[model samples]
Structure formats: structure tokens, C-alpha cells
Target: MTEEIIIAGFGGQGVLSMGKILAYSGVMQNKEVSWMPSYGPEMRGGTANVTVILSDERISSPILNSFDTAIILNQQSLDKFEKAVKPGGLLIYDPNGITKLPSRKDINIYSIAAADEAGKLGLSKIFNMIVLGGFLKLKPLVQPEFIHKGLEKSLPARHHKLIPDNEKAIEIGKGLIQAVQVLN
Candidate 1:
């Protein structure tokens, strides 16, 4: 199966890092993976986006013309990518940062207050991990164990102490998103 996911947000929101984590997890799960990030003129404070591809077989192209899923961390990102997601695709957004959403009926949208949850959890800087959690729960591209293991390897050795917190964030994100699904 081939799954293309786009993670977009303002600069310094850890969009690229989120893509890296997904790519690394795909590797751990024995899947083909590629992550391509674009900064363009938005590196300062503008928009940043990363496309992450995961497949069961060899990947021909890393670039995606259309994405099957998108995680938007800000309203600008939501506006930029809301129209680009493939039909029947999934779009996960941080409702705390993105106040509006496109009126698309073809795509499924999952809104989570990631930044606010991160702030409440005292891990505001690791909001990307929270988003990753939502992605993992919504998309079965890779297993949760693989993601946890990837997180262990993604961070530097000196930062081993942060792994537990990151793992906690992932679990919290998954739980919150899962609850939303259950409620629906």
C-alpha cells in the first residue's frame, strides 16, 4: 500500500521533524519511505510543508502530486493544503491554531487541539509528536510500536531522557484522537 502524507505548519513548528519521524518509523517497519520538505520564501515565518511517502514495495518517486493525508498545524497551512488533499483522504488539523476549515465533503477532517494539549502537558515544543500520535492512530501505515521505537532512535543519545515524555505525548495524542472518533 502506498500512503502519502503531508505535514504543514509555520516555520519552527517541527513540520520537518514530524516527517522525519514518520520516515524513520517506516524504515523500522520495513517499508519504503521518503520525506521531502519545502521551505521556499516561508522559512522565516511563512509556511513550511513536508511530504512523507510510505509504501510496501520500492518507491519510484519521493515527490507527491497529491497527498492522501495532511496534518495542518496552523490556519495558513490549513488554507494552503486543504484543497490539495486527495479525494477520500484524511486531513488532521490543530484546531487551536487553525480556526477555519475548507468546506470539502470528499476529504475526512480530524480536528485536534494539539498546541493547547501540548501546553497543558508541558511539552509545547514537542507538539509535532502529538500530531504524529494522531497520524499513527488514524492511519495504519505503520504500527504504534514501530513509531515508539523510531522515537527512541530519532533523538540523540544525550536526549534519551526526553524519550519518555515524547512517548507520553504520543500516547496522549492517540488517546485524545481516538476518543473523538469514539464520540462520533
Candidate 2:
């Protein structure tokens, strides 16, 4: 199986980190994986994105013009990558700061209130984890054990104390994701 995913958001929103963790999870599962991230020099508030590929066979390249899934965290990203999802693919977004919703009829669309939920949970740093959870709900590509290990591997040892909170955030995200639109 090959899954090509694009995650886009502001730099400080953990967009690249989420992709990294997912790539690590794929590695732990013995799948061939590639992760490529892009961002502007502004860093914090500037747009950031990552492209990740997981497959059972060798990957040809990291560059991609389309994706199987697009996880968008802001309105800008939604506007940018909404049409980039392959037909019949998945488009998941957090509706925060989004003035317009997706309008594609060919792809499946879902929404996750990760930012708001993270605020309510008092663990705002794990916002991306919540988003990751929502993605896992739609696509169970990686095993849970590997995900746990991914967290351990991607996160620093000093901040490992928050793994449980991140895990909880993921659970919250899974429960919060709602289907906005699904192709028949």
C-alpha cells in the first residue's frame, strides 16, 4: 500500500512535526517512508507544509503534485491544497479561522476542531496530535504501537513527559472529527 499525504499550516502549528511523526511510524512498521517539509524564512507565522509518502515498495521521489490525503490546518492551506487532493481522496481541515469551506464534489471532506479542542483540553502544544488523530480515524494506515514509538522517537526526551497528554489529544481528535462531505 502506498499513501501520499500533504500536511499544510502555519509554521508554529506543528505541521512538519506531524508529518515527521507519521514518517517515523511508517519506519517502525517497516514501510518505506519519505518526508519533505517546506517553509518560509519568517518561521513562526509563515506558512509551512510537509509531504510524506509511505509505501511497501521503493519511493521514486519526494516531490508530488497531488496527494491521497490533505490535512489542512488553516484557511490559506485549504484554499491552496483543496484542489490538490486526488479525486476520491480525503480532505480534512480544522475549521478555525476558515471563512470558506471546501466545495469539491469528487473527494471526501471532513472537519476537525483541533485548535479549539486543544484550547479546551489545556494542551495547546499538542494541537497537531489532535489533527493526526483525526487523520488516523479516517485512515488506519499505521499501527497504534508504532505510533506510540513514533511519539517517543520524534519528541525530545525532555518533553516526553507530555506524551500521555498528546495521546489524550489524539483520542479527543478521533472523537471530534465529523464528516462534512463524503462521496457516494
Candidate 3:
């Protein structure tokens, strides 16, 4: 099974971290993985994105024009990668700052109000974990234990104490995601 995903959003939104966690979890699951991140020099509020590829067999390259899934966290990303998802693939996004919704019937679309929820719940730091949780609920790509280990592996030791909170965010995210009507 090969899953090519692009997670895109503004910088400081943990887009890269989410991709890294997925990459690490795929490694723990003994899957071939590749992670590539891109962002403007003026990070923070600038746009940021990461591409993560997981597969059972050897991956040919990290570059990709299309993806099996696209995790969009902002309006800009939605505008950019909405067409990048392969037909019958998945497109998950947070509808906070999005002025326009996705209008594709060929792919399955899901929305998770992660950013708003995180702000309300005071889980802003783990917002990406919540998003990750939503994706896992829909895809179940990697094992749970591997995700825990991935959290431990990706997050620095000093931040390890917050794992439980992150886990909780994930659980919340799982329940928050909802299917949107596929449009033309």
C-alpha cells in the first residue's frame, strides 16, 4: 500500500511536524517513507507545506505532482492543492479561514474544525495532532502504537511530557471530522 500525502498550511501551524510524525510512524511500521518540506524564508505567517510518502515497497522518488491525499489547513493550501488529489482520493481540510469550500465530486472530502476547536479548548500547540487524529480516523494508515512511538521520536525529549495532551487532541480530532457533501 502506497500513500502519497501533501499537508499544506501557513507556517507555525505544525504542518511540517505533522508530516514528520507521519513519516516517523511509517518508519516504525516498517514502511518505506519520504518527507519533504517547503516554505518561504519569512516563515511563521508564511506558507508552509510538507509531502510525505509511505509505501510497502521501495519509493522511486520524493517528488510528486499529484497525491493520494491532501491535508489542507488554510484557504491558500486548499486553493493550491485541491486539484492535486487523485481521483477517488481523500481531501481533508480545516474550514476556519477558508472562504471557499472544495467543489470536487471525484474525491472524498472531509472537514475538521481543528483550529477553532484548538483555540476554544486551549490546545493550540497540539492543533496539528488534532488534524493528524482526524486523518487517522479516516485512513487508519499506521498503527496506534507506532504513532505513540512516533510522537516520542519526533518531539524533543523536553516536550515528551505533553504526549498525553497531544493524544487527547488526536482523540478529539477523530470525533470532530465530518464528511462534506461532494460537489461538482
Highest TM-score model number: 3
Model 2 — which ten-residue stretch has the worst lDDT? 37-46
lDDT of 3 by residue, 1-184 (tens): 9999999999989999999999999999999999988855945678899999999999987989999999999898999999999999999999999999999999999999999999999999999999999999999999889999999999999999998998899899999999999654
> Which rank order by lDDT, best down to worst?
3, 2, 1
User: What TM-score, computed on C-alpha atoms, does each candidate reach?
Assistant: 0.91, 0.95, 0.96
Candidate 1, position 160, lDDT: 79
- Misplaced by over 4 Å in model 3 are 39-44
- What are the per-residue Cα lDDT tens digits for candidate 1 across 1-184? 9998889888999999888888998899999998888957877778888989999888887787788998888888878888889998888888775555556777787877788889887899888888888888887677878887777777788987888888778777887663223121
Sort the predicted structures by TM-score, highest score first. 3, 2, 1
Q: Pick the lDDT winner.
A: 3
TM-score of 3: 0.96
For candidate 1, give the lDDT: 0.82
True-structure Cα RMSD, model 2? 1.9
lDDT of each: 0.82, 0.91, 0.94
Where does candidate 2 stray beyond 4 Å? 40-44, 182-184
Compared with the true structure, what per-residue lDDT tens digits does model 2 show for residues 1-184? 9999999988889999999999999999999999988855855678899999999999988999999999999888999999999999999999999988899998999999999988987889889999999999889999889988999999999989988887888888889999996344
Candidate scoring better on TM-score of 1 and 3: 3
